[model samples]
Target: MSDGVRLNKRVAEDVPCSRSEAEAYILGGWVSVDGVVVEEPGARVGHDRRIALLPGATAMPIAPVTIVVHKPAGVEVSAALIDPAQQEGKQRFLKHHLHKLELVAPLEKSASGLVVFTQDYRVLRKFREDAPEQEIIVEVAGTISEGGLQQLNQGMKVSWQNETRLRFATKIATPGLIDRLCRDVGLRVLAQKRIRIGRLPMSSLPPARWRYLTPVERF
Candidate 1:
């Protein structure tokens, strides 16, 4: 076996930084050996191997992630539903992204739609404090008469957007409130799919896949 130096020691010497800074850079995913990024500070490296540090890489705390998931009916929302392969966002999948995650905008297991999982406490707080005031848009399949539609709109807004479906918008809805409201107004519920929450739209996100809530996106 060839005797190789510790990667952090080599990095500290080559980068001309302190041992601790070198380790920090390594841990921050800034350093690569032979063009392959190696995060472990204690990894052994040969003297002849080329090492490069990516430009603008920093040693800093990893930012918490907020993920928007489109849950399918009857499926549970959990970290098990988050697969690195299914990530459609620009952020690289890190195992830490799944840690300390809290669910927000919870829906019944029987209702499918936009749900959120966040590691940031600020996001959690916003969803919790603003839920009662947040508007939810759901696509529902039902048949109703003009009188029934008018009755449905007495407390909640129901729109016959098309001949094929009905759109329901409400700010005072709980998990099963919409269904209960529809039944109360002589409407038969065929299916329900939540399409939007607050100002966030499900957009093109399909069931079970997720993407990062970008810094620019709110709610």
Candidate 2:
């Protein structure tokens, strides 16, 4: 009997990689069970299949489940256990009740909008590594006492202490200027949501709901 339990799940369990990484392996034809390539992460297999992790592959999830939440302000996007009351207190902030699932990324308490969750580690890794330029839409309700907005228009330097995706922002006086706006607004960002990741936009998905990212959408 082949010992395999869905390519992605097996990969997630065996290695430190995420589910999305396994999917990439499978899709790239990198995963093999008993020397035969398997493309489906949900495909059932024995507990002891001689599974091999090949380089660069993609595995297809049954539903390709991915979630996009319009995270409101106040709650934290972390895996650490917290009080139920705390979670409940931020109910309005949550796009959905996500206490059951593990948060793959850390969303700050002050930041809000477009938090993703999934069992797919590969996807997580891709986001972590590629850090593809994304479009973040933030709406500032209050006015800035200082010339933060002016300095932003002139361009400001921003950095993260930890090694993460590189990002820059600029002001958007244009209607379609997502990147420019983030760069130009240095005042206290009142509200924000990642409207688009790569080419995928969160405008269609319901708030606090999950959707499977199709293979094409993985990039």
Candidate 3:
């Protein structure tokens, strides 16, 4: 290619490995281009450049891990990753389990619901490639006018940045919109919980506990 090919693709073509394995080697800091180590799989290199693997750079298979946690209110989603005491369930955390455990789709501190963490790049890539549709249940006190309900259903416009410009990226399921709707209708929101993401539901998952995704499960 004129602009150079992705490092991973070039590595896979040159080496006896799959693209994913090449990526793993790159991420593990085992790949060098023209004597310089390049960690990014998507790094560009000239077609005629030198590519080398360091000693002990044999393909080592890595198992992907995906964990689902039932988050409780008042706990910061990001903080809970390091603090196992904040997590639910009887399973204890091991030091080895902490490696590359990345939190996904973190919820607000005041919200309680399912949270996801994974060491799998494929799972993370799926989320990044497409915005997963979420379903949330909001509890509010007081009454909502019929007009307000209609407006909410039809997607009302809200202004931000000192009301100088309106946000074009408007949606009905966003938490901000829910809060605005409740405030406009003279209601007080008590709770908000995301119950579903994509086709996965937080069914039967107890609060403050965590579980691993089954082999057959996706997302």
TM-score, candidate number 2: 0.40
- When 1 and 2 are scored with lDDT, the better candidate is 1
Query: Global lDDT of each model?
Result: 0.77, 0.50, 0.69
Better TM-score candidate (1, 3): 1
What are the per-residue Cα lDDT tens digits for candidate 3 across 25-76? 8877688999988877888889888999998885665466677877887887
Q: TM-score for every candidate vs. truth? A: 0.69, 0.40, 0.55
- True lDDT of residue 48, candidate 1: 94
Ordered from best to worst lDDT, the candidate numbers read 1, 3, 2
- Clash counts per candidate, in order, are 0, 38, 3
Arrange candidates, best TM-score first.
1, 3, 2
Clashing pairs in 1: none
In angstroms, the error of model 2 at 139 is 2.5
lDDT by residue for model 2 over 1-219, one digit each (tens)? 245466678767776588787666555556688888776666677767778876633344333234445555575665332323333222222222232454544455655555666556676676667654455545543343366445544543333222322233322222234333444543344455555555566665544444445556654
Return model 3's CA RMSD, one decimal.
12.3
Compare candidates 2 and 3 on lDDT and give the better one: 3
Task: Give lDDT for model 2.
Answer: 0.50
Tell me how far the alpha carbon of residue 147 in candidate 1 is from the true structure, in angstroms, after superposition: 4.5
